[model samples]
Target: MSINRSVENMAKGGMSMEEFKAWVRENIDADEDGKITKDELADIIRRNGEWFAGWKARKWMRSADSNRNGVVDEIEIGNLAEFVQKHFGIKIIS
Candidate 1:
Protein backbone atom coordinates (compact mmCIF):
# COMPACT_ATOMS: atom_id res chain seq x y z
CA MET A 1 0.00 0.00 0.00
CA SER A 2 1.08 3.53 -0.73
CA ILE A 3 1.41 6.18 1.99
CA ASN A 4 0.59 9.84 2.10
CA ARG A 5 3.73 11.91 1.74
CA SER A 6 2.22 14.58 3.91
CA VAL A 7 0.91 12.07 6.45
CA GLU A 8 4.28 10.47 7.16
CA ASN A 9 5.79 13.90 7.12
CA MET A 10 3.20 15.31 9.52
CA ALA A 11 5.81 15.46 12.27
CA LYS A 12 6.63 18.91 11.08
CA GLY A 13 2.94 19.67 11.67
CA GLY A 14 3.19 23.44 11.34
CA MET A 15 6.95 23.63 11.84
CA SER A 16 9.46 25.38 9.61
CA MET A 17 11.08 23.83 6.54
CA GLU A 18 14.29 23.16 8.45
CA GLU A 19 12.44 21.38 11.20
CA PHE A 20 10.36 19.52 8.62
CA LYS A 21 13.44 18.39 6.78
CA ALA A 22 14.97 17.22 10.02
CA TRP A 23 11.87 15.26 10.98
CA VAL A 24 11.60 13.78 7.51
CA ARG A 25 15.25 12.92 7.44
CA GLU A 26 15.02 11.28 10.84
CA ASN A 27 12.14 9.08 9.71
CA ILE A 28 13.12 8.81 6.04
CA ASP A 29 16.71 8.04 6.93
CA ALA A 30 15.68 5.01 8.91
CA ASP A 31 18.73 3.06 7.67
CA GLU A 32 20.91 6.08 8.27
CA ASP A 33 21.69 6.04 4.54
CA GLY A 34 22.65 9.70 4.52
CA LYS A 35 20.24 10.65 1.68
CA ILE A 36 16.67 9.61 1.21
CA THR A 37 16.54 7.82 -2.17
CA LYS A 38 13.40 6.90 -4.12
CA ASP A 39 13.04 3.48 -2.59
CA GLU A 40 13.93 4.78 0.83
CA LEU A 41 11.59 7.69 0.38
CA ALA A 42 8.90 5.28 -0.79
CA ASP A 43 9.10 3.12 2.30
CA ILE A 44 9.01 6.10 4.56
CA ILE A 45 6.06 7.38 2.57
CA ARG A 46 4.65 3.87 2.59
CA ARG A 47 4.63 3.88 6.37
CA ASN A 48 1.52 6.00 5.74
CA GLY A 49 2.23 7.73 9.00
CA GLU A 50 1.54 4.50 10.85
CA TRP A 51 4.93 4.37 12.63
CA PHE A 52 5.81 1.33 10.46
CA ALA A 53 5.25 -1.33 13.10
CA GLY A 54 5.32 -5.15 12.60
CA TRP A 55 7.23 -7.25 9.96
CA LYS A 56 8.10 -4.09 8.07
CA ALA A 57 10.38 -3.12 10.93
CA ARG A 58 13.33 -5.31 9.81
CA LYS A 59 12.26 -5.75 6.21
CA TRP A 60 12.27 -2.08 5.19
CA MET A 61 15.31 -1.24 7.30
CA ARG A 62 17.70 -1.38 4.36
CA SER A 63 14.99 -0.93 1.74
CA ALA A 64 16.29 2.46 0.68
CA ASP A 65 20.02 1.78 0.72
CA SER A 66 20.42 2.34 -3.01
CA ASN A 67 23.96 3.72 -2.75
CA ARG A 68 25.08 0.84 -0.55
CA ASN A 69 27.17 3.42 1.29
CA GLY A 70 25.47 2.23 4.52
CA VAL A 71 23.63 5.55 4.92
CA VAL A 72 21.09 7.67 3.00
CA ASP A 73 22.14 11.32 3.16
CA GLU A 74 20.13 14.33 1.95
CA ILE A 75 22.74 15.25 -0.63
CA GLU A 76 22.67 11.75 -2.02
CA ILE A 77 18.91 11.54 -2.09
CA GLY A 78 17.58 12.84 -5.39
CA ASN A 79 14.25 14.53 -6.07
CA LEU A 80 11.10 12.40 -5.73
CA ALA A 81 10.49 12.42 -9.47
CA GLU A 82 14.04 11.39 -10.35
CA PHE A 83 14.00 8.64 -7.79
CA VAL A 84 10.64 7.28 -8.89
CA GLN A 85 11.72 7.08 -12.50
CA LYS A 86 14.92 5.18 -11.76
CA HIS A 87 13.77 2.92 -8.92
CA PHE A 88 10.05 2.54 -9.52
CA GLY A 89 10.45 1.48 -13.14
CA ILE A 90 7.85 4.05 -14.13
CA LYS A 91 7.77 6.67 -16.86
CA ILE A 92 8.83 10.08 -15.59
CA ILE A 93 6.34 12.92 -15.96
CA SER A 94 9.09 15.32 -16.90
Candidate 2:
Protein backbone atom coordinates (compact mmCIF):
# COMPACT_ATOMS: atom_id res chain seq x y z
CA MET A 1 0.00 0.00 0.00
CA SER A 2 1.03 3.58 -0.57
CA ILE A 3 2.10 5.77 2.32
CA ASN A 4 -1.19 7.66 2.14
CA ARG A 5 -3.12 4.44 2.20
CA SER A 6 -1.09 3.15 5.13
CA VAL A 7 -1.83 6.34 7.04
CA GLU A 8 -5.47 6.12 6.10
CA ASN A 9 -5.58 2.55 7.29
CA MET A 10 -4.07 3.55 10.61
CA ALA A 11 -6.72 6.21 11.05
CA LYS A 12 -9.52 4.03 9.86
CA GLY A 13 -8.38 1.19 12.07
CA GLY A 14 -8.68 3.50 15.08
CA MET A 15 -5.07 3.08 16.15
CA SER A 16 -4.56 6.17 18.23
CA MET A 17 -1.16 7.34 19.34
CA GLU A 18 -1.94 6.58 22.93
CA GLU A 19 -2.83 3.06 21.99
CA PHE A 20 0.29 2.79 19.91
CA LYS A 21 2.35 4.09 22.81
CA ALA A 22 0.91 1.46 25.03
CA TRP A 23 1.76 -1.12 22.47
CA VAL A 24 5.29 0.16 22.33
CA ARG A 25 5.57 0.15 26.07
CA GLU A 26 4.33 -3.35 26.29
CA ASN A 27 6.08 -4.82 23.29
CA ILE A 28 8.90 -2.60 22.07
CA ASP A 29 10.26 -1.02 25.20
CA ALA A 30 11.91 -4.17 26.45
CA ASP A 31 14.55 -2.12 28.20
CA GLU A 32 11.83 -0.46 30.27
CA ASP A 33 13.14 2.98 29.37
CA GLY A 34 9.75 4.47 28.49
CA LYS A 35 11.17 5.21 25.06
CA ILE A 36 11.35 3.15 21.90
CA THR A 37 14.76 2.51 20.46
CA LYS A 38 15.32 2.73 16.72
CA ASP A 39 16.01 -0.96 16.50
CA GLU A 40 12.84 -1.72 18.38
CA LEU A 41 10.85 0.57 16.15
CA ALA A 42 12.33 -0.96 13.05
CA ASP A 43 11.64 -4.41 14.37
CA ILE A 44 8.01 -3.52 14.98
CA ILE A 45 7.69 -2.19 11.46
CA ARG A 46 9.32 -5.25 10.02
CA ARG A 47 7.13 -7.55 11.99
CA ASN A 48 4.07 -5.67 10.75
CA GLY A 49 5.13 -6.29 7.14
CA GLU A 50 5.14 -4.16 3.98
CA TRP A 51 3.02 -1.31 5.21
CA PHE A 52 5.82 -0.04 7.40
CA ALA A 53 8.64 -0.29 4.94
CA GLY A 54 12.19 0.83 5.66
CA TRP A 55 11.86 4.18 3.93
CA LYS A 56 8.56 4.92 5.58
CA ALA A 57 9.88 3.83 8.94
CA ARG A 58 12.86 6.15 8.61
CA LYS A 59 10.62 8.96 7.46
CA TRP A 60 8.32 8.49 10.41
CA MET A 61 11.22 8.38 12.84
CA ARG A 62 12.72 11.50 11.35
CA SER A 63 9.42 13.35 11.34
CA ALA A 64 8.36 12.27 14.78
CA ASP A 65 11.70 12.64 16.51
CA SER A 66 11.39 16.41 17.00
CA ASN A 67 14.44 16.62 19.27
CA ARG A 68 16.49 14.62 16.79
CA ASN A 69 17.11 12.14 19.53
CA GLY A 70 17.76 8.51 18.69
CA VAL A 71 14.73 7.28 20.54
CA VAL A 72 11.03 8.21 20.45
CA ASP A 73 9.66 9.56 23.70
CA GLU A 74 6.22 10.71 24.83
CA ILE A 75 6.60 14.16 23.28
CA GLU A 76 7.63 12.72 19.94
CA ILE A 77 4.72 10.35 20.09
CA GLY A 78 2.44 13.34 20.64
CA ASN A 79 3.91 14.99 17.59
CA LEU A 80 3.18 11.82 15.66
CA ALA A 81 -0.37 11.97 16.90
CA GLU A 82 -0.67 15.52 15.63
CA PHE A 83 0.76 14.54 12.28
CA VAL A 84 -1.80 11.78 11.98
CA GLN A 85 -4.62 14.08 12.98
CA LYS A 86 -3.54 16.76 10.52
CA HIS A 87 -2.72 14.51 7.61
CA PHE A 88 -5.54 12.01 7.96
CA GLY A 89 -8.15 14.27 9.51
CA ILE A 90 -8.60 11.92 12.41
CA LYS A 91 -9.18 13.30 15.88
CA ILE A 92 -7.29 11.31 18.49
CA ILE A 93 -8.27 12.30 22.00
CA SER A 94 -5.21 12.26 24.23
Candidate 3:
Protein backbone atom coordinates (compact mmCIF):
# COMPACT_ATOMS: atom_id res chain seq x y z
CA MET A 1 0.00 0.00 0.00
CA SER A 2 0.99 3.63 -0.49
CA ILE A 3 1.92 6.06 2.21
CA ASN A 4 -1.26 8.04 1.57
CA ARG A 5 -3.36 4.96 2.07
CA SER A 6 -1.53 4.13 5.27
CA VAL A 7 -2.02 7.67 6.55
CA GLU A 8 -5.69 7.51 5.69
CA ASN A 9 -5.99 4.30 7.59
CA MET A 10 -4.24 5.87 10.54
CA ALA A 11 -6.69 8.78 10.53
CA LYS A 12 -9.58 6.37 10.68
CA GLY A 13 -8.46 4.43 13.73
CA GLY A 14 -4.69 4.84 14.24
CA MET A 15 -1.96 2.20 13.94
CA SER A 16 0.73 0.70 16.12
CA MET A 17 4.05 2.46 16.80
CA GLU A 18 5.83 0.03 14.52
CA GLU A 19 3.28 0.61 11.80
CA PHE A 20 3.64 4.35 12.11
CA LYS A 21 7.41 4.06 11.99
CA ALA A 22 7.12 2.01 8.83
CA TRP A 23 4.88 4.63 7.31
CA VAL A 24 7.41 7.32 8.11
CA ARG A 25 10.21 5.27 6.59
CA GLU A 26 8.19 4.54 3.50
CA ASN A 27 7.48 8.20 2.99
CA ILE A 28 10.78 9.76 3.99
CA ASP A 29 13.46 7.18 3.29
CA ALA A 30 14.44 8.40 -0.17
CA ASP A 31 17.52 6.20 -0.35
CA GLU A 32 15.37 3.11 0.27
CA ASP A 33 17.57 2.24 3.20
CA GLY A 34 16.37 1.03 6.57
CA LYS A 35 17.52 4.27 8.15
CA ILE A 36 16.41 7.89 7.72
CA THR A 37 18.87 10.75 7.33
CA LYS A 38 18.69 14.23 8.75
CA ASP A 39 18.10 15.72 5.32
CA GLU A 40 15.14 13.48 4.71
CA LEU A 41 13.69 14.42 8.06
CA ALA A 42 14.28 18.10 7.39
CA ASP A 43 12.53 17.81 4.06
CA ILE A 44 9.48 16.32 5.70
CA ILE A 45 9.46 19.06 8.31
CA ARG A 46 9.86 21.71 5.64
CA ARG A 47 6.88 20.33 3.83
CA ASN A 48 4.89 20.69 7.02
CA GLY A 49 6.01 24.19 8.00
CA GLU A 50 8.11 27.07 6.74
CA TRP A 51 10.10 27.84 9.86
CA PHE A 52 12.83 26.05 11.80
CA ALA A 53 13.10 23.04 9.53
CA GLY A 54 16.79 22.58 10.24
CA TRP A 55 16.46 23.08 13.96
CA LYS A 56 13.42 20.90 14.24
CA ALA A 57 14.96 18.10 12.21
CA ARG A 58 18.10 18.16 14.32
CA LYS A 59 16.05 18.13 17.48
CA TRP A 60 13.95 15.26 16.19
CA MET A 61 17.00 13.26 15.20
CA ARG A 62 18.65 13.90 18.54
CA SER A 63 15.56 12.75 20.39
CA ALA A 64 14.57 9.84 18.15
CA ASP A 65 17.94 8.35 17.31
CA SER A 66 18.42 6.59 20.58
CA ASN A 67 21.63 4.86 19.51
CA ARG A 68 23.24 8.12 18.32
CA ASN A 69 24.11 6.75 14.92
CA GLY A 70 23.15 10.07 13.27
CA VAL A 71 20.03 8.48 11.81
CA VAL A 72 16.71 7.13 12.89
CA ASP A 73 16.21 3.43 12.41
CA GLU A 74 13.18 1.19 12.86
CA ILE A 75 14.26 0.08 16.29
CA GLU A 76 15.14 3.61 17.35
CA ILE A 77 11.71 5.00 16.57
CA GLY A 78 9.75 5.13 19.80
CA ASN A 79 6.38 6.68 20.48
CA LEU A 80 6.12 8.29 17.07
CA ALA A 81 2.58 9.30 17.91
CA GLU A 82 3.94 11.46 20.66
CA PHE A 83 6.50 12.99 18.32
CA VAL A 84 3.81 13.91 15.84
CA GLN A 85 1.79 15.42 18.61
CA LYS A 86 4.70 17.48 19.86
CA HIS A 87 6.05 18.64 16.51
CA PHE A 88 3.13 18.80 14.08
CA GLY A 89 0.56 19.51 16.70
CA ILE A 90 -1.44 16.47 15.69
CA LYS A 91 -2.23 13.98 18.40
CA ILE A 92 -2.09 10.32 17.40
CA ILE A 93 -3.32 7.57 19.67
CA SER A 94 -1.41 4.41 18.94
Please tell me which predicted candidate would have the highest TM-score against the true structure.
3
Writing each residue's lDDT as its tens digit, candidate 3 over 1-94 gives 1123336556555566667767787788888888888898788767655578788778778778878888877676663456665654443555
Top lDDT model? 3
lDDT of candidate model 1 versus the reference: 0.47
- Cα RMSD (Å) between model 3 and the true structure? 4.8
Please list the C-alpha lDDT of all candidates, in the order they appear. 0.47, 0.64, 0.67
Compared to the true structure, candidate 3 yields what TM-score? 0.69
Q: What clash count does candidate 1 reach?
A: 9
Model 2: number of backbone collisions:
0
Give residue 36's error in model 1 in angstroms: 0.7
- TM per candidate comes to 0.38, 0.62, 0.69
Q: Model 3 Cα displacement at 75 (Å)?
A: 1.2
Give the worst 10-residue stretch by lDDT in candidate 3.
Answer: 1-10
Clashing pairs in 3: none
Per-residue C-alpha lDDT of model 1 across residues 1-94, encoded as one tens digit per residue: 3334553345323334455456556666666644554456546645665554434433333553455654445643334334433443333322
Q: If ranked by lDDT, best first, what sequence of candidates would result?
A: 3, 2, 1
Q: What is the lDDT of residue 86 in candidate 3?
A: 66
